[model samples]
Target chain A: MLAALPNPQGVSVCPRRARWQLDLLLLALECVDLHASELMLQVLRELQLQGMIPNRVVFWQIRCTNPFRQVTQRTPLPLAETKALTAVVVQVARRQTAILRHLLLVLDQLQAQNLPPETYAPLAAYLDRFRRNFRKRMNLQRSSLFLYKNHQALNELGLKLLAQLLLCAGTKGMERLWFSLFDGEVS
Target chain B: MLLQRQYSLPNCTLRIEGLSGQAGAEQLDIVTCCEWEIIGQNQRIKGGKDFLVALLNSVPAAAQTWLSGVKLRRSPQYPIQVEIAAANQVSLHIPRKLLQTSPEENSESPTNDEAGETLEVHLTWLQLADLVEALDQFCSDSQTLPTLIPTFHSLPRRAIAPAVPLRKQLMPLGIGAASLAAMAAIFFHFPVPERRPPREEALPPTPEAVTPAPAPTTPNPPNP
Candidate 1:
């Protein structure tokens, strides 16, 4: 998003701190990319028609940076991975800038698709939770293993499991990839 | 100076960097939803709405997906008519000072009671899918959220005398935790009663003294 700048242009002459600023900006971009947005909704309609997101899922597409064709190569990207990516970018970001950075991540994701009702619900919910659970630790804990040690791993996994639980709750017509999750739990 | 806001509604903690130069760069974004049911047969329910609303509001601000939808559903619908006209487009420039500090009016941070915090988040396709998945998940879960032991202390033994799947214990938490699994359920089926007023005593009625006098007067007149 930083223009994918050729030769760094105006950015290079600035001090290393400025370079850090640029880094923060792009990291913010990544955060927006991973989350959901309005544009992503539009992308989903297209993806469903293209036969992505499992024949059962129908249309699971996103509005990512330019490579719409490349998306189908992957299906059902783990929500955690996106979050982790955001974490990396904002490793050194402070509170308010951190907020803008995270919002940008969300905005980027929106750019990838047309936002839908279902999309907004969970997306907003996720961001709200993040501010409570993660931001403080990252800021207060200063990148310690606290998130990992205290709750992140278990919470996220549990949430993922929860997601699987809810996703299967409605889609009786779809094939049971979720059952595999349960089966894995059972076995 | 940084703006600090705490919301118990969606369970969120937000620190808006009013002074970015001083604050550090360690931010976090979390998107999670949890729901369970607590059904009690008979009980006292003082703060079900506040409790659940507090829990929902407690959800952190960085949780973009659920924040966008779950929070949105919590409020009355707002009208949004997007105009796609090309003529309306305008280029705006940001002065250096403007970026340095937002207007004082824009200073307030997100909290539970505010209508703006839960308003719809405009997002992209991937994030939307995540949001949809999260939301479908929230509705599925919120419809039936986990019923903790009905106390700040969530543990069973810690909060109440533990109960088996259907074993009926005295439930130290009282009637609220007694019969049903859901706090909301117990509340609706059999609402907690309000205090009754004290009973009053009735005194005996006075006899018809006036009637006797009138009867005597009529008898005397007839005899005469």
Candidate 2:
């Protein structure tokens, strides 16, 4: 007899591509706060969500699924882990809501004036940090990573991710992010 | 006795009036009235608790995909509807029934259809932010309903894809132009010196010419 399969709705596992997106979001969260790992633990503890994330080792394991990572993990991420990571992202984004709003407003002003993002000190620092973090962690040999070879391309990616994170911080952010993760995968 | 609490921001003010419920001081107050005003626009709307609940639930989803908008509506009793009108605007549609139609006016215009009439108020993003902030404050108050906590749902993927294409196309061009301009400015400020100039002995070297120009600032591209 064949082994029973897990019910899709009852034991929903995260899709393959969502792992990459989740890791990118986590990377963005780290750019926002250097101590993001510790903060994630704190949030899990505070929200009584320790059951989902368990501990730091498990957290790192889930993050290791990012395809760009130098040594990628082959295991699939479950939905619970996905929710835990998303909660952390949303919490961090919520805490920085004012700053995000300010940055976006500044971006609009710069765009209107035709000034580069580098003209603004805070935004420049963020984009630079994201680029540095991306370089230090990701495998540059990957074909997808090859497209981000130029400074301008990486910076634009950073800005786009930043804006997406802002949207994730807004109302119903958790739900919005949850559904978006499964966007194309679901029939 | 009726108690009133208000949260105010730069562009909006939210006011709530209620009385203590029979459940005692430990329980939430029985909300009697809820009101919101767009500060500079000189517009205000009044409703009961249902409207407040609808607003609290609608704002977050609306904030995410603003162009498509999320509507707040509660059946026959509370017909007021709120929708995101644009990137930075919100429109509230208040039914004419809630406006306290005057008896004299009703008599003078007997043929006027009340069902088709509504008073619409437009609010800028800043004003909407203020209202959201105010509602968040209200939600945090201990005297409010614990079960009615705000919840957000993401719109369908198809609805959001069409909203962002224009911004996506225009941003890169603007940034590219700005980057080129900055590069040109740097090049203009520092001139490279050529070797073996016969005119070097004829003119005194200025302070800037004597010193080497600083390295141009550029972000290091990721290694391939």
Candidate 3:
């Protein structure tokens, strides 16, 4: 009697469900690739080359600047670019979980290597500040960031990562200098 | 649609709208410049005092070099003024602590309400210029990052705590303890794993030969 029921094609049945599962799997893989320490290292190198020394209060001010309104109202980025900027802001807001993981990984690695506590203390303090400031931003669902159903959310994440990388470069530099000083003394 | 600009600080939000006549737009008017109206948070200071308090609190410690006299004007006649020089700092001007203490002791007094009214604030030269620039940037569409540098600075540091020497004091003691601990660990734990009976054929024949010798010696353990 069950055989009488037409056997649905394996590819055709619950296509939506299969697609959702694929998206989630892809997202998890993407998250795994987000090596925060490596990325931060690269960012620090770039900042040093550019001679950029980010002030502690700069990011805080940037955060306060209602990034959404600033991007929308002030920026002369084309409409597409504006949309992309919105998506990036949304992506940054969404990627908090992965960012937190990366921060923890950096801390764990520092401790594991028995690096001077001075090296990681500043970083840990900064990470705590970031967590406090962006905790609410992090809780947002990925869907809320999408303005239109058709807009692709691809490049926005990369942009957000770049912004954060630039933002934290100063703190990273200070930490690196302290670490080197302590490391030499220990040796 | 008239392009209005809104800038937000952590505690305060600034909104500016261009005041346009029938012929042409003149100057932008500040529609709102007030602290975030979060319920049950922040002392409920009325008038211009709220803005000054918000400005002072937002200032970074590193930027405190330029903080001078802060004068708050409610009217031309009576103004709450605080001189922030090398000696006096911004913390003295914060109305929160004053307001907090007043409610418990003098909640019923009308003078308490008058105190809030007395400290009406006015924007200094730098603050006004910053506001003007923000409004200009909002109206002019040039692709650039928002320049939201806050010139405000917190009160001068009362004292700078010296860095704690985390590893300095403990290093010598730790070196001695660590070496002894390592020797004790090697004596007690190091040889036990090699003494385990080899199960797999993958194990080298030398380990099998050594394993037999250790088994005999394990029974009279402490003598070794």
Best by lDDT: 2
Global lDDT of each model? 0.27, 0.66, 0.30
Each candidate's root-mean-square deviation in Å?
28.9, 22.4, 25.7
TM-score of each: 0.17, 0.51, 0.24
**Candidate 3: tens digits of C-alpha lDDT, residues B1-224:** 23344554222244443332233443333323232221212333322334433433332221121211112222112123333222111221334432323344333322333555333223322222232233233334232112222231122222221133447878989999999999998899655555668666675568657665544444555765
Place model 1 in a CAPRI quality band.
incorrect
Query: Interface RMSD (Å) of model 2?
Result: 6.1
Q: Which ten residues in a row have the lowest lDDT in candidate 1 chain B?
A: B81-90
lDDT of 2 by residue, B162-181 (tens): 33466898999999999999
In Å, residue B101's CA in model 2 sits off its true spot by 13
User: Residue pairs in steric clash, candidate 2?
Assistant: A171-B60, A172-B152
Write the residue-wise lDDT of candidate 1 on B46-96 in tens digits: 122232333233221112222111112122121211111111111111121
Ten-residue segment with the worst summed lDDT in candidate 2 chain B? B67-76
lDDT of 1 by residue, A84-121 (tens): 22222222122223333244344444534654212554
> What residue runs in model 2 are displaced by over 4 Å at the alpha carbon?
A1-8, A16-21, A34-61, A64-74, A94-98, A104-119, A128-187, B7-13, B20-32, B37-50, B63-137, B145-224
Q: lDDT per residue, candidate 2, A64-145, as tens digits?
A: 9887798788887876667777787778778777776676667656765789988999989888899998888888899878
Where's the lowest-lDDT run of ten residues in candidate 2 chain A? A1-10
